[model samples]
Target: MRVPTPRLSIPDEPSLALPRSFWKEFARKNWDREPRLFRGLFQAHFPTLEEMFAALVDASERCLRGEIPPMRAVRLYVEHEDGPGGIPYYSMLFPLNRNHLPVREDGNAHAYLERVTRWLGGKRFGVILNRAQCHHWGHWLQMRSFLSGFYETVGVPLAGADSAVFFGNYRYTPFGIHKDDWHIFYFVVEGKKTISLWPFEALSQREEVPKEPGFIHRAGAIHLRDKAEEERLLSQAQLLEGRAGDLMYWPDSYWHRAEPSEGLAVSASLGVAFRPPEFVGAVAPDGWPDRVRHTELPGGRDWRMPATLRTALQQRMGRKSLLALERERTTEWVRLLASGAMEGAAPVLTEAPLSPHEWLLGSPARPLVSFPLPEAQVLVSANGHSRAIPAPPAVRRRLEGLVERLNSGAPQQVEALEEAFFTRLTARAFSRRAFRELLDELVRWRAVRRCEPPASQRR
Candidate 1:
C-alpha cells in the first residue's frame, strides 16, 4: 500500500464531520455491493449501556497490568517503522479465562472498573472481549436481549455466531494499513475511530500526482528520506475520518487502518466471521483420519516391543531394551511423517486417508488472472459430485505458506503475508470460501483489516 506525501504538513487537525446525506449515499453503495461488514448495526443494544461500559473498564485495567494477553494471553505487541519519534501503543484482548481470573467479591464489576480507571490516569479506556470468554465475565447473562436487537435490525440470523466485542481506549496509536477475515461494523458506542481506507484495486492502478516534499505510498509503501515519493502515492487514496455515534460501513475487501486521537473515547462493536457448513469437516489433519496415521507420523516414541520382526530378531534385546527400541522406532516414524516426504518441507498431508477431492482429483487449474469474479465455477462433475479445481500453482503455493505461517503463530510472518494477499488481490478473490478460511487465522491474531477478500478471490 502506498502513502502519499502532502505538499504541506497539515498539522493533525480535529476530526471532520459529514452531513447525513453524504453518509446515506456512501452507505447505500457499500450495502448494495457488500453486506458482510456493514450488516448488524442500528440494531437494538446488547449487554445494556451500563453493563457494556462496566465490563470494558474492568477488562482494560487487567490488560494494562500485563495480567491479560492482547490477543489471547496478556502480551503487548508493538511494531516500529523506520521513522524516528515513533510511539508504542498497547492493545489488550478480552474474555480472560474465568477460571484464571481472580474471583472478585460477589463479582462486583463496578469496583474493578474504578481500579482500572485510576490505573489509566482516571480517563476512559478501550477494550475488546473475545467470544470464547465473554460468558466468564457475566456478559452472557444478558446476551439474549442484546442479540435479539442485533438480529432484528441487521436482518441476519444470529444463531451459531462466534463474535467478539471491540472497544477502543482513547490514546495515540498509528495502526498501519491491514485487512481482516470477517466483515466488521464500527458502531460508535462512544468516542471515534479515524480511519483511512483504500480500494483493493488501488495497488495496481498506482495513481499519479505532482511530486512534493513529503512521503508517498502506493504499490507497497516504503518510508524514505525522499519527499517526492510521498506526494504521488497519497493522491491515489480516499481518506475518511469518523466521529462519535457515526457508523462506518467498510466492504470486505477494502484496506483500512485506524488511530484514535487523545481524548475520552469508547465504543462497542461486534463481528461475525462465518464459514460454510461444509467446511465443518475435520480440522485439517488433527481429526479422525490423522489419528489413524498417528503411529506412522513422527514425534512420539518411548515404548514398544515388536516380536518376530526381521529387525527386531536381529537386535536380540531384553524386554526393557526392546520396549525402548520400539519407542524409538515409533518416534522416528512420527517425525518423518510430520516433516513430509520432501526434505526441508514440513509434513502437509496425512497417510491414513484423504477426502475424495484431495485423493483422486485435482483442480481444473487456470492462470489466476483468467478466473471470473464471485463465480469462478471451474469445478467439473465427476461421479455425480462437484469438485473444486485446485488454484494455479503460484496461488496455491502462497495459500500453502499462509496456512503454515498461521499455524506457526509467527506475528511478523502472518502480518506481512496477509497484507500482501489483501492489498494485491482483486475483490472477487476475497469472497471465495477457501481464501476466507485462510484469512480467519488472522482474525484469531486480533489484527483487523478494514475489508474482506477481494471479489476476485471469492468462489
Candidate 2:
C-alpha cells in the first residue's frame, strides 16, 4: 500500500507553516558557509513569527508621539520598476525627505520616522515594507516580543553586542533572487515566502551580473545555469513556508529570495541590524561572537550637507556621505531641465560627454563619444577596442571655455552656452537624462539649490 505524503498544514488562526526539521535541513546544507557561532541555529519556531509581527507594530506605535517628525527620509520602490528588474533591484532613492517626501502631517509618527531616516542614511536601501505607515500597532508589539524569544531560543547572539537600534522589515511583494552582506533574522508574521537558496559561491565563479535594465536581459539570455545546479543546491534548499507565526533565521551572506505564491498574503518581519566583527576565526570569542559592537547614537545628527562647494565636495566625494549628495544633485538637475537647458537630449552612452555642448552636437564623426561611468567600465573595452580622437586647437579652446562656464557661478546665456557646447558635435548630442544626472550630482554636492528662482531673475 502507498503511504500519503504529509500535507503542509497551515492553521486557520495565526501559525507557522513547516516543522523545525525543514529549516534544519536548509541549515545543514548552508551552515558551513556562515560564521561558526551561527551554525546549526536555524530553528523554525521561536516567539512564533506572529508574535514577532506583534512586537514590531507595538514598537512603532509606542515610538509614535504626537506630531511625528516628517519622515526625514524615505525610499520608494513601486512594482512597475522592480518586479522583473533582475534579482531584487531598486530604481529611485530619496535619502532625505526634503528632496523626496511631503511635509510630515502627524506628530505621533516621530520615532518611526527617525529610525527609518537613520536606516536610509546608513544605506540599507533594500529593506522590505508592506506600507509606509502601517496602522496596526499591536501587531508591531507582537513582532518585537517574538524577537526577544528568538534571542532566547538561539544560544548564539545574532545581533552585535553594542547595537541598540532594532530594525524591522516586512516583505509584501515577491522579491527576485538576491543576497545581502549583513546578518539578518526574518520573521514571517503573515503570508508565506518560499525561498530558493544557492551556494553564493556560484555567483563568484560565474560572471558578475549588471544592475542595468537592458544588461540583465542580455545576461539572462546568454547564461542559464539555474536548471543544472537547481537540483544540487535547490534540492537541499529549505522552504521556510512562514505563516502568521513563523520566523526564519539566516546568517550573514545568505543568498535567498522571498517568493509569494497564489494566495492572499501578508507578513511582518524584523532585522535587528549590527556590524560584522572585525576579525574572522573558525570559532568566535565570548565578547566577539558575531564579531562587532554596535551602539545607539544620540538624537539624529544633521548629516544633511550645507551648500558650499568645498564642503560639498568633501562630503559628496567622501567615503562616509550617504545618499545626501546623490539626492541633492538629482533635485538640482530636475530644476535645470525644467528651465529648458537640456531639451531633447539623450544620455551619453559612454564616459561624461567630452563637452557640455558636445551633448547638443551628437555627430557621427565623434564616434569616440562614449565614455563609461565607474560602474560601466568593464563594458568599455568588452566590445573590443577604444577609439582615437583628434581635436583641433580651436575646438580644444572652445571645449575648455565650455567647462569653465559650466563650473562658473555666474549666470549663463542658455542659448550661447548651448551653441558653444554643441557647435562642433552632431545634432543628436543633448540628452534629458544626462542633464538630469549632472544636475542631480550638482544638487547633491550643494553646487545648486532647489526652490523658485528669485523674482528678479524669473522674467
Per-residue lDDT tens digits of candidate 2, residues 329-446?
3233222211111111111122332233221211110111111112112111000122111233443344335434433333444445655555666534444344345433333322
lDDT of each: 0.35, 0.32
lDDT of 1 by residue, 7-122 (tens): 11112211122335544555456642442223333333323334554554445455556655655422221222234334333434244443223224424444444555565455
Q: Which residue runs does candidate 2 get wrong by more than 4 Å?
A: 1-74, 81-90, 93-175, 209-238, 262-264, 272-459
Please give the lDDT score for candidate 2.
Answer: 0.32
For candidate 1, which ten residues in a row score worst on lDDT? 363-372
User: What count of clashes does model 2 give?
Assistant: 62
